[model samples]
Target: MSGRIDLGLLVAALTAALALSPAAAAPQAGVMDARAQIAAAPSATITNGLITATVLLPEGDKAFYRGTRFDRSGVVSALAYKDRQFYGPWFDRISGEVRDFAYDGDDIVAGPNTAMVGPADEFDFDTPPGWAEAAPGGVFVKIGVGVLRRPDDAKYSPFRTYDLVEPGRRTVKIGKDAVTFTHTLAEPTTGYGYVYAKTLRLPKGQPRLLIAHSLRNTGTKPIVTTVYNHNFLTFGGAALGEGLSITTPFQITSGRPPSAEAAAIRGRSIAYLKTLRDKDRVSSSIEGFGTTAADNSATVHDDGLRAGVTFHGDHPLSKMQLWSIRSVVAVEPFITLVVPPGQEAHWTYAYDYAAA
Candidate 1:
């Protein structure tokens, strides 16, 4: 067996000065396995032998800007939102209504038609006259323009977009005999007044099992942002015979609080998130009850027949986000319910695969 410290140093050296395709960058970390491969910039395969997992990196070096660690205890991943592009309206906005502030899945542009967001605009909240209602658009544009983009900066407001960067590359390191893969972003990008981002990848080598991780910065200035991990999984036309069960530290709120409308979704309806269809998509909440006083941790997972999946959060993260893709569940942990600035410490999430 290889020493832990030695393995880390060796992988770091090989990925230190590496750059690959902008659509899907794969650094020759080790070997490849047969799960699936897509023509994306930041994706990984075993360069030599068979491994249990593969790492998928997003282009534009935006995947790994958040950190450099991979998943071994399980599949590890992070959620990255660059610049003021994703922040929505809060406080005030006369011309821009709440609908313009919420996030619509259309603009995400992750794949041919896949989006981190659902069909409807999520996160649209109601507020007083000064604090306008958010429908769902671009968070950064809503926050930046509705509040910051006053007549003073209205001119430059039109130029802001969430497209982080054109694209980037990704690399992966397959550990020996262990279900671990390390992914690193090739470069970073600038947006929302911030100049940092890395490529992130989600590699699933086993049936109904997957892992992911990312590195990112909220920006040098304070910007209200919400980091949500949206996962998309499936059962290949399988029925919910055993049904889907989720466990989290938070007590799970019944409905959205008085402050947010979009979050005003009912948890009881979607708690078990069985089968998801295009029309069955909507925004909801997964309230945490363990500890909300300050930054804390939360763990969540689903019990799958013959197996199960678990996700955990470590330091730097405080909240979790859940979205459904067809039959897949998007699990996201956040630093703050609403990220302002300089709030990032160290955060984590895990995907544990075990027998049912």
Candidate 2:
């Protein structure tokens, strides 16, 4: 009689045990599963031969950016240029338990309250209409996300995901080189509504991507807010450390500054110093810009990859900020939108990519 145990059975048991371990638990640390989640997500790809961008479409049952934070439509999940990838997942995985985000070793993990990628935009985040007046169960209007039910009497916060009351109507038009999303939302309870259309286009022969937006007030209420794009930029998953530089036309000043050891602010640039490990962070509320559209421009470079992107907008800069963790760096630029009933406002942004 042979005394050797079954080799295949032993291997399978060992694998199963590892899978059941706490450190290997998924939807948390075992976040490689995000690959499957992204694959199953519905999206569209647009390219101009120089740059290729894939946007996650909005769906009631399986939307890509399900969080209540950013505008869901035109969510760019992936972008590649010159064989270098940008705007990929900065987190290991997305979870419902995470209030906002938590540092996990080399990766940042996000919760349903704030899980998104690429240049995601948001409108009037600090003051969603009807939030204060709405009862605990009543609903308030969030322009891009839809109607959300008020959870409690607590002050409004972007760190928590409110229950969805309605998503209104979403229409999508996709082309080979461009894609557009139009959201028509009318919340009678808050007396606020609008027709918001956002278009992402890749110029035919240029290494540039453009985002044009038009917001038309369709309801009786006036829509006064500030809309900003969270330019979540990265280069091939490079750490947000040395060799990274962000430049703006105007000199840079900040009300809230980042760690001097992590980042340094020169005359017109935010310079990264040493590498970010563990729970290190860099963030600031950038100020000092005049009322000119030309001032609303920034150029970012990663010297290691010899690649970079420049972001500019047609509207004047109302506010700006810089933020980063270990895996991603974001330059947030804001513009004011004031549309009265039956009126509309328009703005545009351009991103030019370069690699040498």
Number of the predicted model whose TM-score against the real structure is largest: 2
Over 1-356, each residue of candidate 1 has an lDDT whose tens digit, in order, gives 11111222245224422343344212212111112112222333321121123233332233321111111112222111111011111111111112112223421112111212211111112111111222233222222111221222222222222222222223333442222322222211213232222222233343222223232323443434434343333322232322454455445663433223112323332245334333243344456445543323332233454434455445454454565433344444544433344453223344443443
Give the per-residue lDDT of model 2 (tens digit) for 1-356: 11211222332213110010111111222233455566677676677778888877776545556667788788887888888888877777776767888866655678865677899998776887677778888898888888888988888888777777777777777666777888888987688898899999899899899999999988888888888998888676877778888899998898887788888889988998988767778888888888999999999898987899999999999999988887888899999877899999999999999888
- Per-candidate TM equals 0.44, 0.89
Q: Deviation in angstroms for 256 in model 2?
A: 1.7
TM-score between candidate 2 and the true structure:
0.89
Would you list the C-alpha lDDT of every candidate in the order shown? 0.29, 0.78
| Clash-forming residue pairs, model 2 | none
Residue 92 Cα positional deviation in candidate 1, in Å, after optimal superposition: 40
